[model samples]
Target: MNLLSLLRGEAFKRGIHPPQNKLTAERSIRRLPFASRLVVPLSQHIGKPARAVVRVGQEVVRGELIAEADGWLSVPHHAPATGFVEAIELRPSAKGPWEQSIVIKVQPGSTQEVQVAHPRDMGVLNPQEIIAAVQQTGMVGLGGAAFPSHAKMSVPKDAKVHTLVVNGCECEPYLTCDHRVMVEHADDLIEGIRHAMRATGAVRTVIGIEDNKMSAVEAIQAALMARHIPADQIAVQAVPTKYPQGAEKMLIMALFGVEVPSGGLPLAYGMVVLNVGTLAALGCLLPRGEGLVERVVTVTGPAVQRPGDYRVPIGTPMKFLLDYAGAPAESYQVILGGPMMGQAAASLDVPVTKGMSGLLVMRGADFCDRDDQKIYPCIKCGECVAACPMGLNPSLLGMLAAMRDYEPMGSQYHLGDCFECGSCSFVCPSSIPLVQQFRVAKQVLRERAVA
Candidate 1:
């Protein structure tokens, strides 16, 4: 370890060290049984919504494609279980809107065996072929950004990628899915890294894990040794455990000591970063030519009775997950990721999508005592200034948002760079929801632009 880096707190400036409530980190991942009904949304990814291929009453087997990609930026969706399409209608989504969805009713006694497509030897596949195969898997960034994996891997011709940064830093509190994936699926992750490296023309791979997760680091290093991959080609480094360190820019900064330019991507730095869970899913699916139907999710909180990492199918309802996890009977609040940045679910009926990493349930005092409902006046204390990773003046931004001065927030204050990490809100002593105000301000600006 570099003494200077250690002294500078792992060298990435301005981040908080929240209590890592990683309850499920030590637990082995357990597969949840198929739900009786699944509501598969067509627009799970960030691009255009998928076109439904299977109509109502159409029988589909597990892993069979029920929807096709709408465009180059979209991804297909597969049946999570052998079932008949019950309906194709609008359903509530976690995003607080009605979205087109395909509802399926599982067949009685139907074995949920996934019917694999054309399996190929990944070693022989070229870069384009690997990318095409990855698109077929319906993989997305499982680290809460549901951007299509294939799109992310498809580097532009103008840009040259030199490094593939594998993010194994599950920095969010109470989320252990990525940690478990790193610990148990290290080999698969390595294979996926190789594929990603090929797809992006990256010559070397680096897995950045939080120092707190020594087990995952050890597991990945051992896997690399077993595969005889050279350290020069692939290396695992432990970064400081800090909130939002798993963010691509932050991770890249911590690992390489370079800052990605504001309003830019890792591609600009000749690098591509991938989440550990996303790559592991690719490693498991690409070789078998299978679609992503399930993912490992951390179901934990103070209200959960059976807290653990679970292999949950896509489109599994939050209600089913809560029931299985033995959520408290009383009214509870459920968020779809970590406490810091996760969105609170508007309805339990919404199905788990590709971006969801954890199902956090808080009850009683933990739920009702939250300061979310309280909005205090900004004291201009400058805590948000210190907490902001992007070095933006969130206090000024918050003040501008209060005055409905949306345009200035973007034009002068660099509002687009916020990324809504919730750090400002977390550190705000006045309980002002700075991130939320920024979100509204940005939305207003977008609407204005359209007008």
Candidate 2:
């Protein structure tokens, strides 16, 4: 039942691959000039919104906490650039709606000067103290989960986490932000993993990457070796190159040969997986005792003139980033993550946050060519069934969704478990938009529940 034993056996399973289109994998990350104004949404993560501390016209320095964590499940927000507060009100965010936000105007020619972070030895701190210190830094999953990092660290005392699985499997095509982070900031990642081990009391750690990125695997392996961390204590294993392999459950199954029971957390399998980027951010924040005000982001696609990864400050606008990346003015669609699972932006003014790992700009020519975006009936060819890693009948669900028979789909067919990986749509020859139908179905059910 122990997870370590599972890794010794067969690892991860199936998912479809889209074009990697990774135009910036080899490019070094650069820092963009602070936008003239930042619209930092208070609720960037999945939990409670942080409370704003600074008022309008108040001056704030880089890394200064502008909003304090409102609860254990939230993270604080800091000034990414030295600036004066312009307003604290509802603003457009990347999530497709306006949320309460703090806006700032960068002081003319502001330079990067981080506020003095009060640091201390990790050995001197207790587990709770370490958790408190982590909360102070405003860290989140950074891999797009955007769950508060402190909340993740606070596992129930009754549930013991044995293996801290570091997911280096950036399997989503076109998203090399995690890959670049691992290659460039391996030291920080190692240090952060250690902090995570301490936080969770895990006896061992393993960094799992898909085979496509041998360079990242080599880099992390070398970092571990130099640190004198034994091979068995901290490892670097190459998982198969499969889409959704980066999905926490799929990665666990692949790297450790352990299946996370349907709808179960890895803790049930005695494992806790953290993104490589999460560890890297922790490595930077834990020692300095600062907040997560900025993060590394990938801005790439055919529509972009300058396609590469850049360190974007939290609260920068989507429009600014697209322009900064030299995106074509006539681009057709802009996605906030990878094509398979990324959300479409409703407006260009929405600001970036901890959860946005990739921004993809696709022109009309880049996507599948279609006149009128036609929808064809599924021929029941069983392709989707074979393609589904979870082995669900997506054709039936797609039909149900189209017919507005959502209740039967939920009650009789188990619709809630779909994570919307877009696998079925990828395999469907008719291009029935199976994933799109599922999205609408889930949304309708969710809204009905709330209503």
Candidate 3:
């Protein structure tokens, strides 16, 4: 069946369809010039922070390893530009915490060319070697998770992986970095899929794109055909364009008609899902033996004058990017990713880390209008229940959160299954921040558990 027909036939229930403000979807990615200073944080990934290897006053080239992985779960960090190490000090992070960072001052007139290490022939490498090489590239899920790519690619020996699901669904509004990657870097994405399949011992790979991006599906299909990839080995499938379709569980359901068990991963279903942009980075970096120094980021919103997809260095500050994007001088809110899931930037000085996929700048009026909306008591409305993709009772959970009854929310209501997609909050007539309350409850539960 054609992709359009396939999308019509299959869709997960209970997902809100937000306006896809993909203004930069067709804009080819342009490289942003090196910022005068870069603050490379060691804890960009999910696990232990990397150990700094370069000292203050040391000169480092772009793509040069500046920090080493402290453990198997951690990934190394590389210099995003050729520069002198000015200091290793604490800097503001996107998460509103001061993190240890390596500050680099760009050298005058230095051509910021990446110094590639010896390239490896991926064909000769065993699965273990492939995983190691992926780790060395300092890659993480570029889809805002920042989970280490190598760790994700590594499947346990007992489990068997049958399918490699490549996620090209840029479901978030105002974020087209992944869409642009799928369109412009199709070959690299395909190559990355092959490597990921081999690493995980998957028999076949499927690229699940949203129907809205038929152009991406076409590009990927052409790349697969040009490479003569066998039909059964790889195929592109288009799912419905819905909010949170980019989530691994939802995408898996849409494509394969299977639901990932609650509190389990796609791995439990004999599949491994990867983001297209993440794979594209691995495809490009692994062959060249270069560390991940840059990524394509969408810079757009009401306050941006030059909204487009930009290839920005890892440590580039949000302020510098806003300036490059011609952001308005007046007050504006900067979000590190898409509106629904992305966090508001604590400060403009926060550097763009691996997890950041888009930079959304909204005018003060636009931001405050939403913030000023009053929250009312839940009217026992079933809108949140109807909107929840996981089929969890968000209304009950919200009520539990209100009474500080988090344990029942988790134990009885199956609160762990909620992915915080904000669909309930979006559709709520009371304007209650249901997702926010859920997040706070979850965090409190985690803290209590740890204590």
Candidate 4:
């Protein structure tokens, strides 16, 4: 679990190194005033969409359930603030498309209110009760996956999970949300890890953080000591400073010295990975009997005048959020998540959902010149291959994608294993858009498979 070893660990061999632009790490978490209207997307999580129970023009209280899950794969959606259900219709979202969501207009100047609850001591709840409470709270993976945390904890009957990998590596360039959470709320993290251990039946948990943040590691270590949580059962280990080290596969490999077999989850190797923010929120909500209403989102970039992290309520509008965060309108390109795999916002009308972890407003100076950002032919420099964490030949994939040979890309090059971390594009000497080309190729192959 030594993250800073000059000789890299067993699994993660080579990943590109990008400039870590964590501007908000120095600042503390802040809060923003309630936006006028909040839009809660039903399909924020990965699986099935939640079904809305409230109709338009109906009034709902803060923390009231607006949408409930229809199946085990989905997570419920709760009211972030007191408001009237204005509409249930298609709206702009982070996926760069319109999605069906509940639109609620806040009562002007409504008092900031939260649900009243008693903290059920952690020891009081049994295994099943803890899992039920987590599901009721609408908790999802906050590390940008947005998968239902409850579902993740519910390991299959046959699969034996030996190690619970807690991801603290905010390795994505320009994102410090998880880092800030670990530094500021370390106590909650330990509590969260204990809860996960109870749910998963895992004997031990390992907190894997990148070597970049010595401060975070110190804070987490202090928390474990203060709580008298078994230091050996749950240890804080610093991982190497490399792109894609934050990925579940790479982190599990770094910690256990095992590679996840091709086309398999970490569970295939007896491991279950969860994000620190997701675990911290579980620690906060499950004990208090309160549902998920807000989350700490990183709102920082060069285009932002006052960059910092904020405890933003879910359903907050992107436009209103940027305005409150002092984001310069005409000076930056805005995206909903980290620079490596995040999608750009076609319109600021999109509202924050469970999946929107960071609002990156990068300016022109933070990017290459528009006209100069041209794709060049690869000269076979082998940098992309050397940088690929999965060891796939991006040069070959890009060639196949250009030639419209989608079959060979997946069958021969193992395209399904690529995590799309953008390491190849980051290190390509020819400035070739290797990641984008692979994405296009994968999509085409998937469509063909269904057809």
Best candidate (score: lDDT): 3
Model 2 accuracy (lDDT, Cα):
0.83
Per-model lDDT:
0.88, 0.83, 0.88, 0.84
Tens-digit per-residue lDDT, 316-402, candidate 1? 988898898887624888888998888888888789888899989987476335646677888888999998899999999999999
Off by over 4 Å in 4: 1-11, 116-122, 369-371
TM-score of each: 0.95, 0.96, 0.96, 0.95
Model 4 pairs whose backbones collide? 3-238, 3-239, 3-240
The TM-score, computed over Cα atoms with residue i paired to residue i, of candidate 3 is 0.96
Cα error, candidate 3, residue 177 (Å): 0.2
Candidate 1, lDDT over the whole model: 0.88
lDDT of 4 by residue, 86-132 (tens): 99999987777788999989888776676544467768777777787
Give lDDT: candidate 2, residue 235: 80
* Residue pairs whose backbone atoms clash in candidate 2: 6-256, 7-256, 11-254, 12-254, 137-291
Cα lDDT for residue 398, candidate 2: 91
Please identify model 2 stretches exceeding 4 Å from their true place.
8-11, 369-372
